[model samples]
Target: MDYEISLETLLQHLGEEEPFPYGSVTPPIVQTSLFTARTLRERNTQQGRNEFGYTYTRVDNPTVRLVEQKIAALEGTEDALCFGSGMAAIASAFLTFTESGAHVICVATAYTPTRMLLESLLVRYGVQVTFVSGECIEEFAEAILPNTRLIYLESPSSLYFRLQDLRAVSQLARAHGIITMCDNSWATPIFQNPHALGIDIVLHSASKFLGGHSDLLAGVVAGRKEHLEPVRRTRELLGGVLDPLAGWLLLRGLRTLSLRMERAHKSGLKVAEWLAAQPQAAKVHHPGLPTHPQHALAQAQMRGYSSLFSFETHPIQEEQAYAFADRLRLFRFGCSWGGYESLLLGWAQTESDANGKASWLFRIYVGLENPDDLIRDLQGAIDALTP
Candidate 1:
């Protein structure tokens, strides 16, 4: 059965072919802290081999390796590593390339915790980080230092859904001998293939769309085998290996990812378009919308859109923002999204926004719910903003 298959087929069957003692369709979780090596010589031989012949769970786990392979295949990379959490994967990726006094340039609109990791932790450890508007390739160029080791980006960025020119930035980084990493969580592997655009590493918060249930927390980094070895070593040292149960759950989620993402793509665009027509919404920040400033870039770069997007309301007081969020009945007021349930989150301003005023900015995640239902929920909530 050696044949190329579509991603849709790959997702369903890529990692499920392990030979179990019984004829179970799904791979059984080797839920143990350590595996028996059979003999010292065998143990040494297994340790010497690069394949995931598990000596310790912290080093590798069969369940985790299966998901890692699935993710790597999905990302069109040579190898991939899974971590206990998204931040763990992110930290390991950064720490692998950066030493004390190393310089890095990060996109300004990256995830809040990612910025914190760079500004709060990495800075304290003597790493220099410059936050730049990735929307402008020139900012990345101007911020690069002789010692710049990494350029971190999150396209259709965390808050505003702003996009960076991945190919352009990657080419620029290549010329400078700098490695480039991008958080592909927003678009997921389904939509954007950063590696195809020449990115060095592609990272994902598997807890989002990959898990699709919000029940597990995991992260993945996919790239060439050589580039991932250092991150694997760092993950070992940091003890951030995802548990077998979580790995299995993530694999289960992957089975339906194509379906979920397709539904989200349609519903997200429908909702974003409907929101734009509403008087309350000053602007919609979805890349799928023709009105988005970087719509053309997104169209060229991404194969599809994700469920997540943001919208700005006509200037409203802070209380009104809270009231609108509270009024939402169908949309859950929660933090993370990409699950079966719709979510709504309101923020005064993102870290990149300098104004820091009390304005209504709502980030929406359209889920598997019917688009009309989500729209009605949003419309009702917006209606609350009136007087």
Candidate 2:
């Protein structure tokens, strides 16, 4: 089927094809490590071409290919590669384009592991990295060195939810013969299409949203086939290929992605609004809110918002933050989000230079629950803090 269909229709129809043997509704999991070729001539022919006749699971599997195709289609890219985890995908993508002495310009508030990959490991190999606040387009332009080979961005950045002008940054990079990559996990393909905004490559922690159920860990990098070929080779060499079972689980998650995102989007905005009105919340950091610093840019670039966001708490002690989290009944105290259950996590500022109003930061992920119930639960948690 052509991928020009609506997203809702595309999700259901993209991965559907005639199942072999018995013609099942869903594709059968091709779970073998290796496949046998009928003849030497056939095997030689398959090896010579870039066709989909699989010889080994590490290189490619039918089940995994199906998920990759669906994600590529969703991202409006020519191809995609899947990985065992988000970091693996990210690492492979970076290794594909970067080399010794090459420099990278990365957003200041990117995913923690990604920053570490550049600072800790890549630096040892002589790859220089410059971290800049991508909120200003000029910061990226100024950060570019003669050796700069790539620009890494994460809009609505990790904890602060700060946005970058993707088009502006991408343009600046392309003019300088540099590649651009973005971690689009926060706003899944449902809400944002970075490639459409001129990013060279788009990435996702499929475990968060594409998996949707927290039952699987997978990652994806989607872009033109030329850009992904090296990343795919890096994945094969690194041996971080996603298993077939995880691929199947991801397919199940993608089937209902649109539905789940819609509910989460509405509930997230409602909760963000409620948090803003509360006395305990010093600042709310959701792009959907009018009070957000980049609300105009977000509306211009994104179709909708995701469920994950953070808020600064009014001057509260470390113990008070713990007590508030403990009092919550419905929201689970967890690290990850984009699952069926809501989660709340708190971070306390130990440094004296911390913003006085931002002594504690609370990150919230609204789930499939009713917004009113979640709000009441939060209100009770806050009330408990005072008592």
Candidate 3:
């Protein structure tokens, strides 16, 4: 729970010794479909035993449980469950919390897939949802209805890096007896803990920061045991359990999480500051920078910043924006981030705004690259944009 001492130390050693065999430094993969008990009675009662009483890998496994425990500790939760993908975890949470005719309030800028899930899928199930700007707690308050069952948040949202007042929204949800869930992939546990800020559940696309490398796909949900029991049941019934190898990779990723995050935080701020100074960059949307609208709120809630952030460029043609991205040497054109390599994604509004100008927006993920070198790469791209 204590971010400084306990969490940092837990990442290094938590659950490693007990799950591993013969004092193996790294935990074993536990790569098997089933585990047999010595007696019929034991096999019959495995479900009643503790969480580690693994009857099948789909239900539980030592390797996956180890990763779950580490994430639970890192997020300061009573327990956690791992899933095959981020959307699987999100779907399980949404499925477990709401029933037909229930109403939900979600941030407008949550992950695109999550929005699609709510808009495209859940609506078919008779669930109603309202999307709010999330910058103002009043928007969530005003959107709440008598049938509202949940409120979803994504602070420092993926594209704009906009932040919501977690504590404020949590308090509002508690007053309404509504459950609160947060997508914390943007600010990994190393930077922010939504549960500690009063959120009921914390979700992550472990494929990003948690995996550290782009080699694995996994998701995690962490909260109190009671709140997570239903989710765990949903996970089991849905069959979205993480595979053994990905769990092993996540275990390896956890070891260096702290070091990687520290580098990302510093480098991200440096690059954002430089971008803010550029004439072509209309605005930089990094919470770590004081220029950010919610910088003070971010400081009060999060101990650190993530590498991913977005910025708006002075009005430019869509082709020119693409040209700038194509010119970058260090930052790759990719959809995912929080890995070893920097990435760039650019888009422009198809229709002009009230001012009859369409500004291009770009999301940048500052990786483990040297700040100076990345900056030069960006400068080169900017210089070549007009040509």
Candidate 4:
């Protein structure tokens, strides 16, 4: 089914085996490393279904396959594969498409490790990458080369949270016979469906929003069967498959994705707006806000926004920023977000504009807590910054 179907049905009931696997509400984790056949002839037959059947857990497992199906349904793709971590899925996709001398066009602000992968590992293999701002279609169009095999994008990308026009980029890639992949972790499928916009592949760091409870590390790659077939083979060879237990936990996480996304969306906007209006916040970088430069484009593409966003303080000292972060009781200082608890991360050194005015920047993740409580927690911290 397509994205038009209700997400509640897709997440709760889709891909569920009839009779509920011994009538249990949840599917059992088929944790065995091997699925054996009684006889050599049956073994050959089972092995023959290697790509589709479960002869081995590393190649495929029942629990992981179930998670893949639900993810495919959520992404509105024909098939999907789960990986041990987000980088595993990303690396597999890159390795699947790139040979020596292949070129890739990537957004400048993609996840840091991804950028590192492109700059370090991929370059070592003779593959070249061009990083673009991704603010306009022409930037991508101009960067394309004869050897360009892929265009990698991360809309509402890390930290600064810049956005790209997925439909535009997808069209550009298709016209050039190049594959397109997008990291959709920021605006989970509940808020944004990248595949529906014609992207060749949709990727997710399921460790974030999809896992919901911060208890699992999983990555997802979804696309047409033809596109994902080679990626699946690469996954098998690379040995980056998701564990069965993590698959089961991911299943648990998917059930509440819609509700959590809704909560995050509302609470996030409330907090972002409040921060934007504050005297200390020089700027807030949330697309949901009308003050955002690309608010119209964001509204055109995404149905709703998620909870992670960043803001800049009005030229605060590094120690002052640290003091503010330390003062907050409710917001935990951590790198990753998208779970039940609120998180904050500040750059200790202030960034300077071209004119050399320094300003401290910070990212906030509004969790499943009451927005008012989180706002109060933030207010207490900002109040601490006062003389």
Error of 4 at 341 (Å): 0.7
Given candidate 2, what's the lDDT at residue 329? 89
Candidates arranged by TM-score, highest first: 4, 2, 3, 1
lDDT of each: 0.89, 0.88, 0.89, 0.90
Clashing pairs in 3: none
Which window of ten consecutive residues has the lowest lDDT sum in model 2?
A: 349-358
**Whole-structure CA lDDT of model 1:** 0.89
Q: Write the per-residue lDDT of candidate 4 for residues 194-248, one digit (tens) a residue.
A: 9999999999999999999999999999999999999999999999999999999
The alpha-carbon deviation from the true structure for residue 89 of candidate 1, after best TM-score superposition, in angstroms, is: 0.2
Q: TM-score of every model?
A: 0.94, 0.95, 0.95, 0.95
lDDT of 3 by residue, 102-184 (tens): 99999999999999999999999999999999999889889999999999999889798899999999999999999999999
- Candidate 3 weakest ten by summed lDDT: 43-52
Mind giving the per-residue lDDT tens digits that candidate 2 earns over 268-353? 99999999998778789999999999999999999999999998875665667788888888998888888899998888744433
Task: Give the better candidate number (2 or 4) by lDDT.
Answer: 4
